[model samples]
Structure formats: structure tokens, C-alpha cells
Target: MTATSPTPSVVSSVSTLVRSPAPAGLVGHRRAGRSPAPLTTGRARRARRVLAARRRPADRDFRPDIEGLRALAVVAVVVYHAGLALPGGYVGVDVFLVISGFLITRQLLKSVGRGGLRALPTFYGHRVRRLLPAAVVVVLATTVAFRFVGPPLKVRDVATDALFTAFSGLNYRLAWVGTDYQHMGAAASPLQHFWSLAVEEQFYVVWPLVIAVVAVATRRRHLRLVLALLVVGVVAASGWASATLTPANAPWAYFSLHTRAWELGVGALLALAAPRLVALPRRLAGLAAWLGLAAIAVAAVRFTDATPFPGVAAWLPVGGAALVVASGCGPRVGAERLLGEPLVQCLGRVSYSWYLWHWPLLVVAPYALGHALGVGERLAVVWVSLVLAIASFTWVEQPVRLLHWPTWGWIGTGATLGGVVTACSALVMVLGPVTTGTGAAAVLASVDAPGAAAVTVAPAVAGTGPAASAATSAAEQAVARTVAAAVGTVQVPSNLTPLPQDAADSLPPTSRNGCHAGFTAVSQGDCRYGDLTAARTLVLFGDSHAEQWLPALDQLGKAQHWQVVSWTKAACPAARLTVDNPSLGRSYTECDTWRDATVARIGALHPALVVVSQSENVASSSVVPQAFSAATVATVRALRSAGAPRVAYVQDIPTPGTDLPGCVATHLDDVRPCTYDRSAAYRYPDRHAALAPALATASVPVLDPAPWLCTATRCPAVVGNVLVYRNESHLTVPFSRWLAPVLAPVLTTTGA
Candidate 1:
């Protein structure tokens, strides 16, 4: 998060006090700005006091080092978001929070000291001028730019995020959506980075009032002590909450102000003790500064995406920032000298605007270019954002901040900007939904557009002999007719089963009913699906890939007089390998627990058949296919040992990485672009190859579903007037139900 408040104005306010030349006696005694020789006599001691007075804490003057620190923090964040090697660069937000706490607290405490909260209005006015102008510009620019470059399906999300940013509530919105599994896969919002700005702004609203209350309660005496106690209380409570919640609910812990306020409180504690910290010896101060930098560097280099964050991990960067600010209270150090470099200062100057502009450009560029950006293109985006930030800082930020305006003028400025965002967001929402003009349903119906029939019909229809009909079954013959009629089908049917916009909601009964578990769920709760009273039981087991077949299984089970039980969870693969869930930022212990419980539950059910399916993408980069296959074979053996009469492993469908609904909507006229090559979907290191040998040894049959969903070389996004894959991989409910007839024979046969 960019620290919205800059130090230049604060530094300028105290410049006259610190910038004046030394007295005549000091000029002779002090050589080249170094302090005079150590005082021994009473007269020398008095001169020493004067020198100390001249060397006031850097906090009381323009500390270019603070500006340089801002540069470091923003650069880290940018690099991390740009997919660089610095995994822990996210700690930059912690540094900014601490800095905000220290700087804002200093200003507030000074106000209380002067006139007992008389400066509250002025403090807020300054904040408005400093923060809102540049933010409004970026929000407006992002909304407009995305409107032009982004897909229509994503327009509404970006607009909503922009509106929240304008209202200073983006963090709350992000927190809610971050934990929502349904929306988790949506394209990144351009204004998503504004969540940090929202955090700072929210803190600003509450902290000044706290200072005012403390001053009144203490009768303006012992105010610092009371304030310190209050800050400590906040730190303890928020820190405890962060530590407890991060592993269990990372999104709320990461984005909520309640969990984040402690970092700022740490900075506030430093501000309270600033007056006394100036007495530290120069050597000790220099050491502290270097140690602080070292701590920050260690965190940035050592931590990774899998590290649980914003709890104990945050203390490193937060404490380091405090030390840096505390060091500024004494003398200049090596850290300070490096921080004050011209290039660092320049970066610091426009860091706020750069933070605002960089994320939006990175998100929109791929859509605009119609492809993912290469490393060179990403670097180009970084440069372009820097240029825009410089321009925003020079023109909009300086002009609005320097203007001499009344309180009402500031209020009006905020309202106008907010209004513009609202209007723009409304415009985006109104224009977001796109329709591929209606096509002829008659053409599709006449051809009997083959949905699953594509796989079976092609081979049988190609054969001219009457023996082909004799060779194929009755159900296969029906599929053959649909496939033959739909051979050259290219136009998308007007009567599409699930409209593109609503396609993602095509979940199975188990998913809708509480049978399908969520990420944190450990047990498969009452997941029985069909023919509840049937004598024979069938179990559908694994992750979402298994759940995707539920519509078919449910219908088939009822017709075949078999009970259907669904055991599934989001992102929790049936494979035995332990996963590192990026969302939780840790090893997926919950998944292991769920898998164990599911195995026990299935053992108790003593199902006549257990059909297992898991996503091909389940094995992450760290887990090799051999490990996955071994784990899977073990699971199959365990199932047989637990009384499952038969076990079948269904091969996963080819994953079309593109969002099918959005692609269908965007390329409605030319459906060919929406189809995926079979080779790409079944690319290298195939899960089937790994599992085949082990499964064969275990005598478990492997069922390939490709023959039902695809042709020899490609898989169409839409088939037989029904949308196929809903999002990236899951099949739509309508399509899954259509497969019930084809899937029935395999489930019924003794060999299956």
C-alpha cells in the first residue's frame, strides 16, 4: 500500500527551525558541520548543549531518508505484483502502515499539544488534499481505460471495485470477495490495490478521535503515557486477532483494518517516545538503522507465497520500520545516507501515484493485447506506470494540494470526485452485459447438434457398412444420428441451454444442496444424492472434477435403482500428496483431514461401486506425477479393503484454460475461436500415464471421458445447443445430465 501522506510538507513545516546557520562562536568551533570537541569545563558544557540543540531529531526537519524508504517499499510491492522473484515483497505494505502510524500520530499529537484538538479539521483537510486528488484521477482513469480494453464480462467487477475505492471501502469489499470461493476465480480488478489506501483512510478516521479523547481524559497531562497505553492495547488485541485468524481465514486477516491497525500502532508508539529517543548516542543510532534495514531484507528474501502472513511474519517489517523512524530521532547514519540518494528520493516523490497506476495497467494490458504479456512487456508496463505517476504527481497532486481552499471547498472536491466515480461505475454496469445476437435454433435442431455424441458418432458414422449399426448399441445409434446431423454445425444455437452469463451457476444438486463441501469443511455432510432407498449404493468420490459428473450420476442412479453418494470438496484433491494452498498461504492440513474422514465414510457405506475422479492440475509444480499416481493407487487399495465391490477411475476431461462463458460471449459470431485443441488439453506429464500402471496392477479399470466430450483433435465450447464446460473446466449441469444415458451402460456392466 502506498502511504498516502508525503513527508515533503511535514519537512517544510519545520525547515526554518532546523535549517538556520550556526552562531558565530559555533562557526569557528565546528569544522565542516561536525560537532565541536567534547566539552570538559562549564563553558565547554554550555557550548555542547547549544550544539545538541542545533542537531534536533531528523523528525523535526526534512528527512530525505523517509522519502527514500517510501521508494524502497513501493518498488518491492511493484516487483512482487509484476511476478518477480521477491515473494515476501508483500511486506512492503507493513512498512507503509508503520510509517503512516508514526507520521500521522506525530501530527495529531502536536495538534493536541497546541490547542487540545482545535486542529482536527485542518488535519483532515490536509489529508483530503494530499490523498484524494491523485486517487480520484487513477480511479477515473482505470475505469475509463478498462471500459475500452477489458472484456464485457469483467467490466462490472472493475466498475464495482472502482466505486468502492472512491468511497474508501474497497478493503471491506475485497475482504468479503477474497473468501468467497465462487468469485475467487474472477479476473483481477484494476482497483484491487486500493484496498491498502482504504485501510489507511479508515485508520485516519478513528485515530485522531482517540488522541483527542486521551488528551481530554488526562486533562492535557500525562497524555503521552495514556496514548502509549491505548496504542499498546490496540497492538495486543489486533496482533492476537491477526495471529489467530491468518491461518484459518487469511483474506479477512490480510485485508481487515482491525487486524492491520497494530502495525500503525507500532509506529504511533515510536512517535510518543520520539522526544526521549533523540538522546541516544550516534553510534547506537547508526547500528539500529542498519539492523532495521537488515531485518526488512531478511523478511523480503526468506519468506515465500506459502508463508502464513500478516501475523507473526508481519512483525519483522513493522518493527524494522519503527527502528528506522526511531533512528531518525538521533543522528544521520549509513542507512540514512543511502536512503537520501537522489534516485531513491525521486522514486519516493511519486510513489503514491505509481502505486495507484501500476496494478491497473498490468491487469488491463493482457486483455488489450489479446495475449499474456512476456517478461519484456511486463517491464514495459512498469516503465509506463512510472511515467504516468510522474505526470500525476506533478500536475494533479501538486495543484490540488497547493490550492488555498476553505473547508467547504475540500468537502466539495471530495464529493465531486466521488460523484464522478459513481456515475462512471453506473455507466459501466449499464453497458457491461453483452449479447451475441440471436441465432437460428431451427438450424441446430435440424442437425441434432451432438453434445456428448461428438465422441461416439464420428467413428460409427464414418463407416459405410450396415455392420456399423449392428456393431453400435441402440443408445450409440441415437448419438450417431445427432452427430451425423450436426457434422458441420458451426453457428451457436439461439436456444443455448445455459446463457453465457449464467453458465457458471450451472452447478449440480450436491453443490446446491450442502452435500458438496467447501474449502474449510472436513466432513462430507449428508452428501447422499439419488435413490436414497435403493439397495445398491454408488459413490462419486474426489475433488470438484468428481463433483462435475454428479448430474449424470444422480439421474443414472435413480433410473438404475442405486443410491448415489457424493463425496467432494473445493480444491481438495483425492490424491494423497499434501498440498500447499495458496489461498491459506500454508500446507492444506484441512484437505488431509477431509480426505481421511471421506475414506472412513466411504468404507462405512460399503458401496457396490466407487467412481473416482480428480483434476489433472491437482499436482502442483512441487509434486511429481509419480507421487500422485502412488497416492491414488493406495487410495484405490484402501477402498477395496474397506468393502467397495468395484473401483473405477474416470479420466479427467481436457481443461480449456479460457473462461468458456466469457469467451463464448465475446466470440459468439466465430465459435471456432472458442474451441480448444485436444493436444493442449492433454499436454505433457499426463495424469493418465502416471496412474495407468499402478491402476492396472491394482486391477481397477480406468474410464476415459474424452470419448464422450470431444472429437479426435478438438473440443468445442458449445455442443448440441448446450454449453459444455461452465467456467474453465467444470461441465454445465445440462450437459452433464445429457451424458447420463451414455454413462449408464458403463456403470451397469459387471466389467465396468
Candidate 2:
């Protein structure tokens, strides 16, 4: 009896793609018009054929040229990171991504054909063998090296980083931490490359599921549609996210699986559509490949560390990779040819091991040797990395993958990984709290100050508690008593010219209670005894770095008896230009607008003085030069043209350390830790000199307080038991008040 049933052609086609090796004669078959048969068929005979195809020898031999491409990528990345001439070498990662996607997918498709669409466990087992052994060895070595050579803070950081690496969450962790790969800190941790590994693993976990779903739903006919949607969706999403986010947000988008999926997807699409894509002429393919390489190079050179990244800027590398893959002549031209060289291919063959070893060596070598490496030392690090990569790839990676260990080997590997993770976790938990330091003593001391000594001070009778209080009370009582005596003693006949009651009542209500009136009574508030009734009012404006000197201004205002008004915001420097502040939810357009408004308001009041100071923390090579130039010109023109008698520009205070707060924290145990290396602090010698020229051109006098603060030895943190600065750059209130004695002279001379 013959039985007929609907056949599954789709299933048969997939089986053929997976089980059968690419034919050696297929290279010659390229010119032939005969199409390859679909892989799937719902029959016992076809299933047997699929299984038989697996035993056939691979006709298209393994290409060493691909390894050469890998070599080029890693070399470029290593050299670029080491501060060499190859700026655009970072794009090599894109090339690696494409290669990884193609190989992994090809293997998975083959598995699907033999097993009838499900073999996740076996697939993951292969991944474990291929990736885990080398990774485990590298991480273990890095942990030991870091403990000895890294700083205390960095040791703590890298330990946490190691845990993330183990779980394949390193990419997200790095994005959250705002790590800058190019211009890393002196105490930078060694495990940063784990970010890329995390991205790859995440892609692996999801990509198979996606392929499985598409295969089961569409069979073989709609495979191209699924690939197209995935590639387009991921690419568009990444591009959009990149354009909108800040530089700080770029890494999260760039490194995460959700963002980088598109690059891998392109490779997968090319594999599934290889028949059509591979039809291009050899010359055309070569040109496209070279063009891709050029685009990648351009991006690396032009992009700076501060450039907003992983947005539209990422297109150059990702697109270049797609071109190289589609061109199918990576064996012939440009980066491909360069990478295909014997030496280059050898490096490529061991690229994974090389990547794992290089970063840690570069990070730890300088510290183990007790100083940063010069050019020669850097070369030594590169050589050592290459040697280690070779050793690791040969000994650990190769042997582990080739040897088919029993279940016992799996158990042993699992236990070792678990023990390492547990030990690292315990170390971090034990050390985290020990680092906060003893701020309790400082806090207790502050609570014991004289003002806080008596929380419940009895209200003094007629203000006679102390000599200072008595003198202040006497003045208030005299004014009140005089006004009171006038009220009763002068209350005379019908109309004695309406006795100036408003003038009599000008003394505040506090005067009736025998307390000081007006600003003198409100001494705790930032106010002084000044002519509030005066026609002219002067407004002092700037950031806390500027506002710290309020005592100096109060003293000057008191002496001159001029009305001093103030409007200040902490850490908000006045700038003529606007930039987006991700924290504030809008562009900072108001700083300059406020400056103009303040000037106009002051002009309306016809003030004798308009004092402004902004101690901006500007790097030597910044846009500040242009911003400052414009601000200086505008300020000078505004003050001079507005008819104010004087406009004073206070110079910036000295920054105590290269990093202000970190420097303070690092030196908490040191008596003279504030002494920084001047060469490190001053990159632009001309910045200070340039300021003088700009200030000289201004109609206002530029007041420089550097001479008073700096000495030959260094800028001391404490002077006469007073902390010169509470933090890094701002003067403590006590210190600023103490400076009144010295600064009083400068104010007098400048005012004159």
C-alpha cells in the first residue's frame, strides 16, 4: 500500500543548509544556473540523507585569512588604546562582531537541521567549551595581579567588576559607572574588556531564540523577511538612541545587546541571503571592502573622547562592517589583505586570548614597576601581552575545547567558578564600610561651637548679658525711647505741622524691644547696616565659588554705607553661551540672560559699584577661551557703557588638587597632602598669562587674590589652624572671615 501525505519542503531546505558542508565544487558552481534544493522534507528518507550529510568532509577548507582579519582588528585596538598613531583602530571591534555572528549562526543552523529544530543544551555546551576555559584563566590571573598592583580604591572597583563579568552584566555596569575607556584614570581597573564580552553573550542568548521562532513559524520561505525586520529594527533603534542621549549615556546604548544587536543581525542576514549577495563582481567587491575600511579609519581619527558617541557616529564602524561582509572580498583587499598576512593571521587566531591579557598588563605594569611606563616600557607591555595570549590560547583554550571531558570535568569547573565568586563577594562586603572614614569626630566638634553651646538661652533683660550685647542694645533703646518720649512730650495743640510720624517709625520694631534695628539685628542673615532707602543699589552676583567672599563685601558695604544686594546660585558659573544640562531638563540659556538683566537692574538703580566674580573650573584646551573672550568683551562694554562708577572682576581661587574632592579624600591622613604636582595641574601655562591680557583690557579692575593664597612651597590647605578651603576650591566661612583683615586693604585700594 502506498500512502501520500503533505511534504515539508521548508524543513528539508533548513536540514540541507545545516547538515551538509558547503561544496568544494560550489565555488565553480557559482556560474551555473541550477539552484540548490530546499533543506526540509517530512519523510524518513530525507531525514536519513540529512544525517548522512553531516559525516561528509568539509570541502571548503578553513580560511586562515579570516584569522588575519582578526589580527588587524586586535592590533588596531591595542595600539589605539596605548596612545599610538592609529586613532581609528577601535573600529576593529565591528569587524570582529561580524565574524562572530557569521560563525555562530552557521554552527547553530547546522545543529537545527539534524535535530529537527531544538538542541539548546548541546549548543550551549559547545559555547561553554569554546569560551569559558580561557575566560576563567584570564579572570583569575587578572584578579591576583590587580590585588597586588592596583590602588586600594581600584582593587575594590575591579573586584565588583569581576562579579559582573562572571554573570555577563559587565556592559550595563560600565555604562552605569560612566567609565571612559580612552582616557582612563590613574587607578583604572583592569577588567574593562568584559563589557564587550557581555554584549556578545547577551546576543548569543537571544539570537538563537529569534532564529528558532522564525524557522518554526515561516519554515524556509519567509526566512528573509524575518532577518530583514530584525536587522532594520535594531539598527534604527540604536541610531535613534545614540542621537538623543548624552556622551555619558552613549556607552550604555553602544555596549548593550539591545543596541549592538543590529551589527550582528547584519551578518546573519548576509548568511541567509548569501546566494544573492555573493553574485557581485570581484572588482566591485574589492572596492566596497576598501571603502568600508576607509570609513572606519575616518571615524576613529575624527572622534574625540568628549565627542557625543554611539549615536549617529557609530554608523561609520557598523556600516563599514556590513559593507565588508556583503562585499565578500575580505580575502582580497585593504584591512582584509593587511590582516591576512602570516603574522597578522597568527595574532587573529589567538585574538580572544590577546584581548583578555592586554588590558590587565597595560594597567598593572606601571604600578608593579612603581611608576607610569614611558614609550619603551609600554612596548614591553605589548610584547608580554602577545606572549601571554599565545600561551593561553594554546594551553588553555585549545586543549579545553578539544578534550571531551566527562560530567566530572563540568562539575569541577562549576565548583571552581562558584568558589571564586563567593570569595570575591565576601571580600567586597567586608571592605565597603571600612572606607567611609571617621567623620563622626568632625561632626561632634562642629556641634560644640559657642553659638550652638546654649540651645535654650534665656532672653536677656534689656540686652545686658554681655558687653557687646549691652552696647548694641543701648543704641536701639536710645532710638526707641527718643521716639516714645517725642510721642507723649510733643503731643501738642491742634496742628503742629503733622510731626513726621513715618520718619519717627523708620526704626524697626526690634528697636522698641531694645534690640538693634534693620541689618544689624539680622546679622545672621547676609545683610548689613546700609542705606536701603538710598536711590542706588548694587547687586553682587556669581556661583558659591564667588559667594564665599560675602564677608568681604559686607565689610566693604558697611564701611562705604552703600546698599549691597546679592543673587547667587551654588556651582552655577555665569557663561555667555548656553549648553544642554541633562540634569536641569533645559538648556542653561538663563546664565547670560540673567547677567544682562542684573546689569540693567543695577543700571536702573544707578549703583556706584557692580561686583561680579565667577571661579569657573576650566581645562586648558576648552571652549572656555571663546566663551570667556565673549563674556569679557560684553562685561566690559556693559559696565563702562552703563555708567557704573566701578565694576570689579574677582580672580579665580586655586584648585587644591587635580581632582578636588578625591584629592581631599586621598589626603585625609596626610598633614601636607594638598601639595600637588604643578606640572600635572598646569597643562596650559598660557591660560593664566592670557587672563591678564584680557583683564587689562577691561574697564573694571581685575582683583587677583592668588598672591595671598599661594606660597613658594605650595598652596597650603590650612593657615593659622583654619582650613583654607572647606572642600577643594571654595574658602571655608571661617577662613574667608579671617581673610577680612588681609583682604580689607585690597577692597579699600580697589574701591579707591
Candidate 3:
């Protein structure tokens, strides 16, 4: 719908279009239509003036009950989000949406009757006053809390999110993150409230224009017809889109203007049709209201985080809200009385502030404490949110909206907000990296190590000759001589060189670095060196999922005397075929370019062996295993054709769980209880099945490590006192070291 054009002539003609008042007599109760006895003639005229001051030609008496309904909606939202035993409470947002549409449409229609259906600036001014004050206060407070208390990763992520909150795009962001908000845990964002605000703000931007266009186009001739068409169109479009998209596409469906339009349209329809609908008998109206409340309550109790949302499921709350709006006060029924009770009405009055304050409190509280909230902590957060909401409503929101602040005052407010954001951004920019802590740094460092540990094996007893022993002695002597020369002319001790500082630092506290070529410092003679200084270099590559095997590789390196160089990037799998590079601002580039270069360099050095893996978990689009197999076949053929020998491909480990860290953390106390659903973990079994053919065609020996890692029933957590994995699909250092004995036999095999 197009916006209402703001022409000077239209503004001047506003007063000429006022409508006549509604019929003076109440059709039902005799007491309803009668005015309260006038105190005096002067007082009566003042009352009339007050009525006239409402500024709408067809303006009816104020309905404070609607405000009471708003309070109910906000309370439901707050309570459900607080993890109270109310599931359907989130539907309150739908209630508010309908309410907003009704109120906004009513105001616009009243203005149209008095003036000439065009006052875009005045409408915007009222909205700015109504919303901005409370929004700004909440956003500022959330930003401050985030800067000091949030986790390093979250702090960095939410800086952008806070900006989205300020601009009203939070709904989009939340949707993009996926709907399993509860599972996100510490990773859950702070500016989640922006989703509802986004719906409202988006509505405000478009609804006024639609109203103006319809009012002008038909001049109220076919307004109902036009409104009906709009509602049907929006509902259809939203339903179609929601059904077609995956859960990952929730943001586009939930946050986009098209999908959310029907909700506001329902509200708009209510405003235009309320007079007729409200004429029903009070008993029936009351029944409808109670039924509506029941629907909303039921939804709250039954809905869980996994529920497919804002699709057909959204109808429960929307329908409930529509019923309440149509019902008004019922005859002989206590529903209206229950809703209009002082407590409910008061909550409705301050509901806006409550909505603004609750989420930030919930998000920041647990983060500040460095833990997720237990039941008690979540309740405390809820209480604190209520207190803050009430205070903001009373002290900041109400005052700013009521006061006649000058243009300069608004400018000053904007500047203050801008300054606050800029300062927070600067603080985050300066401190974010420093606060990411030593953990990530250590992880990256360990990831950069050259190879696993190297061990010297004795010659075979019977058939093997002294030639093998002689060759081994020569290699050991060469390593010792190189160390002696590098450190000065002193005699080098066996296993004397230190592991790379990065690798050592990167390993977890429980890990023991074995004697490898790079490590030299010894405290208690526990091997601390990574064997990166081997005669041959073997590069390990793939996504973070694949890179998790560093510990195992380190163990293998010590046994085989092979350098395990890692060229891994998060979310990137090793493949010879081209795929999109999201970070590179390019598309369809080879995923294995870095690995290829490393292979060329290693080939030039002519290492005795080359080992490759990452055949599984590659992007389907890249046909990763096939590409990797082709590359390996070419490399092996090139090497074999050159008379070089010994190249092998290791099959990838099975993914343990969908969100390994969260699952493990959640079930940390459970023993003999860890479980994984293999179906959920693997989206493409066919792709995994396809890898075997490629590996066979390449004629490379495939090392299936799954049997070593998984058992008959499950992939157990511990293997010989070492945690099998540090995360979802990666091996812990201790576990990798444990695999050293098993891997040694495989590495020494001669043929492909």
C-alpha cells in the first residue's frame, strides 16, 4: 500500500470532513445511554468541551478496558518467557498486534472524519512520542549491561544486534539464528525483544499509508471490501511462504513485512467492524472473551521451543485477541470484570515498557553470572524485569511522552543515544579480542602445529636385516646433529627438541605433549615436543569438525616421524572442487587450494609418506569426497609415477550430536546416559556412502576410525581414561594420544 501524500491543501481541509456523532440513546440498558447528572451548567459545558477535545469527528467515549487487555497480553509474554509454567503466554504478542491495529486505525479514521484523511506528520509525531522514549531507554540500558557482563563471543555478536534493536530489525536477526532459542544457551542473544518491536514498527510504516490510500480511493465507499481483500492476501502469502521454507528461513517468514501483515490487518479489520460486532448480546460477548482467553492459555501451556512458529500455530493468539476486542463488556458474565480488574488494567497501562525491559534482563542476568539460570535465577530475573519496567514506564516513558519537549530536546536525545552507542561500540572494539580469553588462542595455536609425535622402532627379529636398523639409526643421528647445530656445538640428547610453543600452549591442561621434533623444554621428562621436525610433512585439512583430530594426529606423528601440518578454517571442508567462499566475496572457488599448495611443497620435499583425510562432512555442493579422491589419485599417480611411495586417505569420524557442546554441558552429570540420534546428526547419508567409491577409485588405503571411536550401541565418552572428543566431532588431546598405538600400525603399512 502507498503512503498518504502530505499536501498543504489536504491539511487545511481537515475540519470540513468531521462526521456526526453516534445515536445518543443506548439500545440495551436504560442506564448505559443516560449521561451522569450534570453538576452545573458551567460544568456540563466543560464536559462537552472535553468530549470535543478528543479531535475525532466520530470519537466515542474512551475505552480504558482495551488498555486493561493490553496489560494481560504483556503479562502473558513476560511470564512465559521467564520460564514460568505458561507456554501460550507468547501469544500475547499476537494480542498486542491486533490491539495496535485497532487503536491505530481508530485514530486514523477519527482524524479523517474531522480533517481530510491526511495527517501523516502528526501521526508519525504521535508514534515517535509513544514508542521512542521507552525504546531508547531499554536499548541504552541493555547496551551498557552487555558491554561489561556479556561473554566475549556474545558481546561481539550483540553489538551489531543492539544496532538492529535501535533500528527495529531484531525480528529478522532472531529468525536468522534459528527458532531453537533455548538450545542456544550462552550463545542466545540479548536484543531478542526487537522481534516484536520489529513487527509493530514495520506495521506503523505501512498501515498508515494503506489506510490513507483506501480512504482516498473509495472515500469510505468500499472500505470493508478493500480491508477484507488485504487481510486474505496477507494471510495467504504468509502461509505459503512459511510452509515452503525450512526452519532456517524462519527469519524471512517471521520478520519480513509480507508474513507479518495479516496480524495487523486483523486489527485494522476489527477497528472498522467493531461497532457492528460489539452489538451482540453481552452474555455471548462475555462467553467469546472467556473462550479467547482459554485458547491463549492453552497455547502457552502446550507450546515448546521446537514448535514451528508464526505459521498456522499463530492463529491461537490472534483469534483470542480478536475475540476479546469484539466482546467488550459482557452482560451477566464475569469475563469483562475479571479482565478489567485493577491489577490487570494497570499491567496493560505499562505493558509497553514491560515488553521493552524483560528480555534484556533475562539475557544479561545469566551472562553476568557466567552461567545459565536455574529455575530460581530465572524467576529472580523476571521479578527484576518487572521492577525495571514499572520504573521506566513511570519515570522515563510517561514523562517524555507527556512533556512538551522542544525540537532541540529531541535532537539532544538523539545525540545522547548516538553517543552512548558509539562509546559502547568503541569499548567493544577495543576490549572484545582481549577478552576472548586464552582458550581460543590456544586452540588456534595447537591447530597450527606441523605433525604428530615421532617414535623410533627396533628392527624386525627374524627376516628383517640390519639394513633397516642402520637406516633408522642414520635418521635419528641426522635429527640429533641438526638439533646440536641449531642449539650450538653441545651433544644433543635423545628426544631433546621442544614442541612448537603454539602447539603446547594450545593443548588443554590435561594433555601431555610427547617427545616430538619441535618440543625441547623438559620438566619431568614427560614428552612435550610435537614431532613436526620430521623428514616428511603430512598436511591435515578440513572444517573445524575435521580439525578436531589434532590430538590423534599428534600421537600418530610421534610414532611415524611424519610432520602433520594443518591448514584448517572453521566451516570450511577440504575439497578439490569449487564452492562458494562467503568470506572471500567470491563464489565457486576450489576448497582445497591451500591444501594443494601445501601438497606441492611437501611433494618437492619428497616425504616418505603423505596422509589425507576429510573425505566425509564436505559440502554437498562441492562433491567433496569425489574432488578429494580425484586430487589424491592425481597426487598419488604423480608421486608413484615419480617412484615415490606411501599415500593414504583416512575416513572421517562420525558426527556425535547436532550441538555437541550444549548437549554435553546439559548432561554433564549423567553417567552411562550420554546419547546421540545418528539420523539428526547426518543430513546426507548418501553423500557419506558415495565416498567409498571415490576412495577405491583413487586406490588409496582408507582408514576407517569409526570402529575405534564407536561401540556396538553408541560412541562412548571415554576410551582408556581419555575423553573421546572435546566437542561434537573432534577428538580430545588425551584421546588422540591414546590412538597413537593403533595408528602406528596403519602408518607403517607399505601398499595403497
TM-score of each: 0.84, 0.62, 0.57
Q: Which ten residues in a row have the lowest lDDT in candidate 3?
A: 436-445
lDDT of 1: 0.76
Tens digit per residue, CA lDDT, model 3, 683-740? 5566655555665565555555554454323455432222344444555555455444
Candidate 3 segments exceeding 4 Å error: 1-62, 112-118, 179-186, 219-225, 246-248, 329-333, 405-423, 430-433, 436-752
Measured on C-alpha atoms, candidate 2 has an lDDT of: 0.54
Report the poorest 10 consecutive residues by lDDT, candidate 2: 515-524
Candidate 1, TM-score vs. the true structure?
A: 0.84
Query: Evaluated with lDDT, which candidate comes out highest?
Result: 1
The candidate with the higher lDDT, 1 or 3, is: 1
For all candidates in order, the CA lDDT equals 0.76, 0.54, 0.55
Q: Root-mean-square deviation of each candidate, in angstroms?
A: 6.6, 18.1, 15.9
Report the number of backbone clashes for model 2.
11
Clashes of each: 1, 11, 30
lDDT of 2 by residue, 338-370 (tens): 645555656666789888888888888876897
The predicted structure with the larger TM-score, 2 or 3, is 2
